[model samples]
Target: MARPNLTRPNATRPDAAGPNAAGPNVHRVQPGASVQAAVDAAHPGDVVELAAGNYPGSVTIATDGVTLRGQGNRSVLVPDPADHSACAAAGNGLCVTGVADDRGMPVRPVSGAVVESLAVAGFAKNGIAAAVTDKLTVHQVASHDNGLQGISVEMSTRTVLTENEARDNGQAGIFVANWFDRKGGALETRGTQVAANRLTGNRIGLQLRRVRDLTATGNLASGNCGGIFVVGDDGVPRAGSLSIANNVVRANNRYCEPNPRLDSVQGTGILLTGTEDVVVSENLITDHSGTSPMSGGIVLYPSVVGAPNARAVVTDNILADNLPVDLADLDQRNGSSFMTNSCRTSQPAGHC
Candidate 1:
């Protein structure tokens, strides 16, 4: 498939030289300056550039075709005790949201926004939160030590999250959902891509909840309670039609206590629950060992709401040393198949 030509806002690095160094479209903010002020003053095609220093406040981007960039990891955003912005009040380090309806669904998505090359930490909620956005690109950022997801996107389409680092977040390193506050059927993401990222030490590395038409590829996940999770429930248009490929998942044995919604998570590499028409292929999974019911290399299990997975294809993967088994298809209602996988053991045997 041909790659789509994603729209990008005008951007300039903080250290660039020559005529484009500080163009008229660039809004530069120093350490103590207000990033929100610069963002508010920017036009649709403008770039809001942050200098290499600590910025102590949350920032919200509602304008279209804007880019918020920083000087690599040296540009840091932390929570501010005195800030009263809606994003700060929501405990998010950075937020991009469009106009919403009465039901809190976006009527018009924020379009063509890019966020890159910064570090966001120590927030009470998600580090980077994007809701109802279209064609958003998040690249080369470091998000860690947040109370919730490191980077989260909900009800977004054509979003690209690539080459970022998410570590030690309280929840999933990267989370994508149809809706965070309500229970509903899967929403099509229109080719959202999560690729080439590094995820470690979070409760879950990457989680896809009630969403479809997305791809997670070329990622590395380890030291999390679970490497990757594709979850659905009893809702209509259930989560499926996605691809998980070319990922390196290893030793996701970090123990996490059971939450109200599910059991304890540990030693889970790739888990698919209540999903259908999903493809799991070309992954390297190893060394995930635990006694948890979800532990394994590649697992197909029933959802929390007792919906069984169907029509899942697990093929051409390499797996080793996973506890209980390398492949476990515990779903009773079966349309799932495991073929041509290189593994030692399986739950019902002969899958390898």
Candidate 2:
């Protein structure tokens, strides 16, 4: 679902900003007025331009090089899933709060931000919620049914959520978080770039909480329940380099989650619990089976008994019929490193 360009060109804003001399570059958005009043009357290298249809509310892009484009999927914004009071104070529907704004006083962040080709749906929360962000950019948007995430980046840096279209979101359909730094020790989202997205039916179709230098490539996480979840909520150590390559991760545990800690991540397909130097390569990760016998296709949930030192390297992926085993490893992770994975089955026995 590519080619819906909105004048692209936001490769994580390498110095972005254009049209100088105090004003005008492209600030359309004029029919009846709104879209945060044209982003509070544009400024730094402006370019508001939203003129297709339903733009109900929530919009916040505290100007930097702002470029909230539209008119691709006929520009829709929906919000009002209970009124976020019009977003950006704490609420979000399209809030790219980068470079600053963290409630009480923290300032200076909104760097070259850009949200393109709009279509963000019903959001009571995230449908694009960039946090202490950096050079942000979310292109070809189509974030659907969101009461929560459909693109939520926290503590962001070098952010670049590409070719977007995260579906049915109630939480995670492309989420890259990190933060922890009050007393929780360090951890701040390092250079990130979850590319070529299309994560389906949400609940964890591309997460990466407690992130670190990441680069989840060519995504296509299917049916979501656990298509690509990499956690480490707060063991500190700021996670590690995660480079999940060439993705296609399918049939992710299709909906269980009545909340037994999210029903142990339903029907998995790439669940790396206590994140570490991860790198599940050359993906095609297949259809995860249901009814939770720890449904799978790449489960490496280590990190409690002894903690910290949880590595991963399931290489050359193409994993087949994902059920109770397509490559399991629940804590046998003593520096984990499964070889040439073309998975059928593999546990604490032999690298496979």
Top TM-score hit: 1
Best candidate, lDDT:
1
CA RMSD of each candidate after superposition: 3.9, 16.2
Predicted structure 2: clash tally: 7
lDDT of 1 by residue, 115-220 (tens): 9999999999999999999999999999999999999999899999999999999999999998777888898999999999999999999999999999999999
lDDT at position 22, candidate 2: 41
**CA RMSD (A), model 1:** 3.9
Residue 132's lDDT in candidate 2: 75
List TM-score per model, in order: 0.93, 0.37
How many residue pairs collide in each prediction?
0, 7
